[model samples]
Structures are given as structure tokens and as C-alpha cells.
Target chain A: MPIDRDDARRVAHLARIRVDEEDLPALASEFNAILGFIEQLREVDVRDVEPMTSVTPMRLKRREDRIAGGGIAEKVLANAPDAREGYFVVPKVVE
Target chain B: MDGLNSLSISEARDRLRVGEITSMELTQACLAAVEEAAALNAVVHPTPDLAHEQAKAADARLAAGQAPAMCGIPVGIKDLFCTEGVPSQAASGILAGFKPAYESTVTSRLFEAGAVMTGKLNMDEFAMGSSTETSVYGNTVNPWKSGDTELTPGGSSGGSAAAVAADLCLGATGTDTGGSIRQPAAFTGITGVKPTYGRVSRWGIIAFASSLDQAGPMTKSVRDAAIMLEAMSGHDPKDSTSADIPVPNFEGILTGEVRGKTVGIPKEYRMEGMPEAIDELWASGRSMLEDAGATLVDISLPHTKVALPAYYVVAPAEASSNLARYDGVRYGHRATLAQGDDITAMYERTRAEGFGDEVKRRVMIGTYVLSAGFYDAYYNHARKVRALIKKDFEDVFAEGVDAILTPATPSAAFPLGQKFDDPVQMYLNDVFTVTVNLAGLPGISVPAGLDPDGLPLGLQLIGKPWEEGELLDFALAIEDRAGFVAKPKRWW
Candidate 1:
């Protein structure tokens, strides 16, 4: 559970945020503070607490689940920076 | 047209129905006011031509004796909702040029009801942050408070709140996952309501947290909120989670019939640093309700202390998953690496350059909580706390309390960037407001009075499921007695 420089860097990289070398220390500190606060929750004894998913105790409504094929290919592709042929085109993955 | 800008939604609708004024004049007034307040940065996207076309159609319908429920009112669609041609971004760098192909059920329903879309108002990135300062588009200044100082129009929905408060638009659509609508409304001295979870459709709302997010009305008056909510609510086949319950005639429910109604005053909402002025004002609000023939009861929502923590976990976890679509290949502001580019690098680079610091911080926390080793420890535990918080409300409601009263926020609103360095303090902004979102219940923030610093404070009202009409009715009664001016005096 320790957040060293490498862990912070890897996390920053995974999150796609550019944390400069100096900023890494600050980000790490913040992460630690958040973790410290979260750790406090461990002290609470909720042995019998049921995991509540919503405020109202109503169950999730079910319907005949089916797919619409997104119904709007061009619409989905519209926001794609380099979209083509009713699809989002990205650089090839492997050689 | 009789100062259409000053009229409530009910008045406007009645006038339109009786042929007192055409839809064209009203829509034009809204558009003109938006133009006049261009300096407030309240509008992110404007479609004057489309709005004029829609208004003409509305007028034509009136001439032909066939008008939809909300005839010809110009409403500012919060940019968070996906409109057909109008671009929708959750006000983040990640989805700069994104436009949704499908319309959100709420937006589509309003359009169906004969409301004109003025344009998309600005918001905080992914509905994060209290001040709209986090938006990629610059901060939304409080349109009511005119000056070069650029005060904090409390946010995530600051733009919509500001627009409505300044009469840029008669009303605006606001989405509150956690305090997005109410906080901003309180700051701008307008009435903002966050309806029960399923009361409105979340389909195509550009998700923040799927479960907690719901859209509602931000308007100048309670009756306006009601009319707008009726038009916005209903069953949407597209959004299965949407409530199938019939939308009530919200205007029909606001008869000030709150005699003998029970309003709960939860002791937990009195946070440690809460201003004494808010404490006294809260007392005054309760007394006014009592004098109006409602019983004020002291209640305890014991689990309220845990609401902020549960909200932080649930909202971010969902946000992380939802925002994963912005990984370069899917949409918007792609960061292209030089040759030898791999897929992992592509995603990393794209997201790195796209999201702001606040978003990245959230994503990291979200990922951490939903990670393989931590899912149960963080996300599941938060769910347990979430249930407890819900139970607390249920217990109070079961004991004859019709609604809960508390301060909408810990303080009115601090200066912009006051708590930027401390994320915890920034998160604290939602201490009073987040519980409602956590519980998926209806809540509203009506401006009460100023704090010691002369900043506006809000009296929040929390209601049980599908009880928005009743809650708004009570709040509006309070407003009539409180004599709250819909527009702040200093508002430009």
C-alpha cells in the first residue's frame, strides 16, 4: 500500500496525466493523504451491514435486454478524431 | 409582452395559451438577453437560428390551435446532456469536439413538449468541482453579481444557474450527480431542484455516475421548476432505469397546501465549521414553516456523517469506467505518438494530454478502488455505507417527517481557487449536498439569506421518492413569505 515515486509515476502514466518529476512528490503526497483518510474507514465495525446499492430500496427494473447495434454508426463515428467508413479508425496495434 | 423576462414558467405558459403573446416574442427575448449577458461566459454553445426556427413552429402550433405542454419557452440545455446536433461535452478537455449521435431522453422530451433549445450552457469537467473553474471553457461568472471581480457562481452547473439567474434563459436543464444543480442555484440565488433518481431519464446524459445522476429544473421560481419538471419527467423506453410512473401536473400540486405537513430537521447536517448565521437562518426557516401550519420535528439521520465518503467512492468509480471511452481511438483530442507507437502508449498519451489534474486525480482513485485487489475493500464497503445513509432517511420519513431541512452547503461559496490545493477541503463542499445524490432522492436549494460575509446561503429541502412536487410546494410557500428576489440586486 506504499506509494513510492515509481508507483506514483506508473499511476500517473496509467491515468494519462503528465506529472513532472517535481510534481510527482506533490501528487504522491496527495495520494497518501487520501489513502490515510480512507484507512480510517477500516476502524468502523459493520459486521452486519448489508451493502446498499441505492437510497430507495427499490430493485433494479428489468426489461427484455437487447442491443440496437448502436443504431447510429455515423453518430458514434462523428466524435472520433480520425473516423472513417462508419467506424473509429485507430493506428494498427501490432506488426 | 409584459416583461416576459420577469414572468415565471406558469405565467408564460398561461399567456401563450390565451394568445396574449406569441412564442416568437418570448424566444426572441431569451435570445436577446443571452446576447446582452455575453460577457458572463454563461453560454458554451448557442443555436439562435435553430431556436428561432423552433419558436416559429411553436407559434404556428398556437395559431393552428395545437400547442404542446411547454410551448415556446427557450431553455438552456446543460452541455452535459447529448443533443442531436448540439455538441455535448461534460466540460472536460478529454472530449473537446465530441457530439453525441443520440439525444438524451430529457432533452428530447423537452423538445417534444415544444420547448426551444437556446444553446448548451457550460459546466465543470465531468461534473466535478464546486466552482466552475474546472471547466475547459473558462469559469462562469455569477451573472447576477456584476463586476470585474469574477465571483464564484457555485458550480458544476454554474453556467446554467448563472444563465437562469441573469434571465439569459427563462430556465435551464441542470444535472446533479452530487450538488451540481442545487449548489450552483444557491450561489446564484435561484431555485434548483434535483429530482428523485428515476424521476427523469438519464439516457444520453453523458454519465458521471450512472446510478446517482439525475436531471432536473433550475428556474427563477418554484412553480417554474414544477412546470419544467413535469415536461422533463416520464418513462423513457430508451432509458430502462427511467421511472415509468406517470408525470404529475407539478403546477397542480403547488397550492400552498402544506398545513400540518411535517418537515424534519436532521441534527447531523450541522457540520463543525458551519457558520452561526446559517444555524440561525435555518432556525428562522423552520419557524416560518411552523407558523405556516407545518409541524417542525427534530430528527436524526445518524448515518449522514458517512454520506460524503460513500459518495466519493461511488461517483468516482463510475466516472472512471464511463470516461474510459475517451482513450484516443474512440473520440476526441487524440494524442498521436511518433512511430513505434503501441496501443498502450496511445491510450496513456491521449488521456495524459486530455484530462485536467482534477479529472486525473479522480480517475486514479477510481481505478484504485475498482482494481482487482481493492474492489471489495473500497467500492463494496462504500455501498454498505450508502445503504446506511439511505436507511437513515427512510427512518425519518417513516416517523412522519415529510421532508428534511438543512443548509445546502457548509458555507455559501468561497472565492475561486480557495481550496484547490487541498482536494479534501474541496470535497468537503458537498458535505451537505452529496447525501441526497447518494440516496438518489429529490432535493432543492432555495436562497435564504446572506452569511456574515454577505455571500448567499441556501436552505435545502430533501424529500422522499417522487415527492418533488410536494417539496417544491413547501419551498415556494417559504419563498413567498421570505420575499426572496429571484434576481440578486447586483446581478448584471
Candidate 2:
């Protein structure tokens, strides 16, 4: 399966990464190359095989629904690029 | 160059226990060596103040007659492991100047064991590339040289391998998703162990491909790897994938006795056009194990050829999801917006400026594969193939095969820029090692011999799940037989 320039541009959008129009051709070609490599998996007979949910045989561990630990809002927001009044600031979305 | 910093972990431990040397002295020696070897670009963030503080604490522990094997030993922490108040950038511009508020579980354990932290070593950005060339800090040059050309230390654990090989640090931490640890170890003539999945806690290590990512040790020798790995392994409640199993005394079980053990030679790994030197090295490893009273049996892993392709799919898909937290709203780099750009534009521009070319390529591919109408065709299909790849190992192990032996890498270290432009060629470097990760089994790379160019090559040993003790024991056997004491001439 080959991806065209339009598909590449759409993928960059879906990934929330900006890809210029001029670079879409090169990106599409790179996608084609990788897709060509992975296309070999189509040949494997996976009729009755189950997709692996976990590598180990163990089930997901259950835990009590209690607060583990959280109170230092300053510590949690320490790395935030823009924090005001102990809240992360992002661009206005509902305008 | 024969200094305290060059001493192996076991050697340093013995010296520290007998009061022959202080942790402060060892830490100073390593700090000076890290300064001298600045050309290698191995230690990206040298934490001298923290190192001195840790050394003082370790010396106190040693004097109190309470010391573990790692007490007073100076080791490099790969930048992927977040250290509180220390820069833990995974060699990425996106994470430029990012410091975690808390300590990673692995580093915390090492510190609790009284291990001295020399510094944070370099790695591929987000552990993405095979060459460390993708590092925002720049390429970490391999201490080994081929002619006048500077070779890669082999990534994304390239800095870890280079630091250990160059004796800048006694041992260093490394994480292997797809041969990040083993490949670099082979390239630098050291020992690297990728313990069975769930063996080491991944609580604070920056995520790449969660299912496949595993933290291990890269050291000068197999015994040193054993000592370092035991200190690093255990269960953590923070990481649910962490196994709740007892970490065996890895160093104690390394008796170098493999009598009557059966080693499997996977027929599928003998890829066509493999460098003759690598093939010869594999043969020597086989004979060495046989000489140690182990029986050699030829086996077939029919899905070996698909491991690499499947890995590229699975790893990137997970990476695409794991890396989604790097939005402009929170930590790390946020692109300065243009006059009228909206929130979506903010995300697009920030990510565009943040990620490198290879990272962008992977993210795009991952998004394309996981998109509507293509999910079953690519992502789920790859998962089924991954199951088959895992079963291939299960079938072999069930038939009394104690371990499998193969070339650690397709070849020895190449010049830094040789395959930088060709992503496919670079991906081929992990051909022989990805099968172990896909199967979630323990695997190790022990420096076996040198190529015709006098570059070091490693032989890999694959073991049953959660059997790292046995794996390390077999690796010790190979290490003793090979006697791989050759070191690169120090030019750095």
C-alpha cells in the first residue's frame, strides 16, 4: 500500500505535526519505503492466531480504588511551560 | 589510562570493601576521565556536585560495615532515566533543559545501594536512532576507530557503550527496545544484558515502545554486568508491567559451569551476504560453548526474517502513542506562535520544531498505519505476526534448548555517517537481536572477538524468560572461553 502526498499531509495533521506542502512528496516516499518493508506481514497465515495483548502471561493487576498520593500541585506543575494559579495555560479553544 | 575509573564494578567493589580506596577517590578519577574524554561526547551531563554528595554517602556506608556489591562504584546513568534536579533529556532538543521533579525507580535503587552517580550519558533522541547521530547534543563517537574515520558508538545506548568501553565510567545503564543495548555493546567491545521483559522497573525511564522497552546494564565484563543488573532489577508498584519476582543472586550463580546444557543455533539467523567475519565469530562462539561441555543443536525460527519489519511497525505505533504527551501546553519545548495561529496550529508547529527527521518519519508512519480503515491491515496484523515470532522462541525453548547463540550484530561498528541517510540500512542492524525482544526473553551480548579491521564484535546468547541468572551464567562461560581482553587504543 502506497501513500500519496495527500495521504502524507493528512497523516501529519492526524499526528499534530506540521508538514509543509513541499515536503509531503518526500514524506510520502519514505512512507512507501517503510510500507513496502512491512508489507511482508500480509503473507503470514494468522487465521486462528490471537493478537498479543501482553508479552507475559500475567493478567493486569487490580488495585483498590484509593488515592495513591497527590497534593503538591506546585510539584506537579513545576515543568509546565505556562502555569498560572496552579493551572497549565493552553490556547483558548472554545472561542 | 590505567586508572581507578577503568576498574570493573567487581574490582572496584573489592577495593572499596578492603579500604584500599575511597568512593571519593574513584568518583574523582571518573570525573577527570570524563573531562578528558570530552571528545567522545559520551557524558552529556556531568553532575559533579551530586557525584561528590553520593560519594560521601557511599563512603559512610562502606565504613559502617554495610555495603552491597555496587557500593562506592561510579556508574553512568543513561539520560533516559529521569534524575531529580538533573537534566534528563533523552538527547532530544524537544526535551532541552527538561529536568524531572522526581527520581526514576532504577536510579533510586542504584542510589539506595550506595552506587555513586558520575553523570548522565548520551543516547539517541527518545531512544530512536541506531547511531546517536540523531542526538540533539551531536553524535557520540565510538572509542574504536577504523582508519581515520570516527565510527558510531552504536545507539540508542551508544553513549553508555562508549563510556564503559573508554573506561570513563565503570558501568552504565542502558535500555533495549530493539538492540539499543546489545548492538552498542558489540560495537564497543563490552558486555550488555537485556533482561527478560518485566525484570527491571520502567517507572521513570522515558517511554519509547512500552511493551519492548527494558532497562539493563552495559559493563566492561560479564561479571560486572551481573553485579550491576542485580542491583537494577526488581518489582516496582509504580510500573504495573514490573514483575513481582525475586531477583536472583546473579553474581553468585555465575559459576561458569554449563556442562550438559544444550545451545541452539538458529538456522534462520545466517542471513545471506553476512560479513564473513561475523559468521566466523559465531562459529568460534559455538565451538567455545561446545568446548565448555554444552551440546550444540541446530534449530529453525521460521519467523526470524519478519522480526525487524514487525518491530518497526510495533515500536513506532507505540512510540507515536507514547510521545503524544509532548503537546505545547505542558513541559519541554513549546514553539513560539505566529500572530494568529490557533491551538491546533500551536500543536503542529511545536511538534514540527521539536522532533527530528527520523522521529517525524516514525510518527507519520505510525499515524498512517493506525488511521481509520488501516488499523487491522497494519497494526493488528503486525501484532499477530509478533505472536508468531514469540511462539517461534517458545517452540525452541520447549525442546530442551537452554540458550540460543548468534552474532550480536550484522557487522562491527561502521563509520559514523555510512548509513545515516539510508533508514532501511540502519534498520537492518537490529536484524539478529529483535527476535529476542519480540519474544520477551532475556538476552546478552558478550564481546567475543575482533573483526578483520580490528574492531570488536559480540556474540548474543538468548535465554528463557525470567532466567537472566542462567543467561548470565552462560555468558560468563562464553566470556571465560573467549578471554576477550582486547581494548581499543585510547585516542579520545
Q: What is the C-alpha local distance difference test score of each model?
A: 0.82, 0.92
Give, for candidate 1 chain B, the lowest lDDT window spanning 10 residues: B143-152
In order of listing, the candidates' clash counts read 2, 0
Evaluated on chain B only, candidate 2 has a TM-score of 0.99
Model 2 alpha-carbon drift over 4 Å, by segment: none
Tens digits of per-residue lDDT, candidate 1, B190-300, equal 889999988898888888889898899999888888889999999887776787788888888788668989999988887777778878878878987887889988899
- Using Cα atoms, each model's DockQ against the true complex is 0.57, 0.85
Model 1: how far is B423 from its true place, Å?
Answer: 1.7
Q: Which tens-of-lDDT digit does each residue in A2-95 have in candidate 1?
A: 6787778877775655577888887788778776666645655667999875555555677676775756776667777887777677777767
Model 2: per-residue Cα lDDT over A44-91, one tens digit each: 888999998899888667889999899989888888878999899888
TM-score of chain B only, all predictions?
Answer: 0.96, 0.99
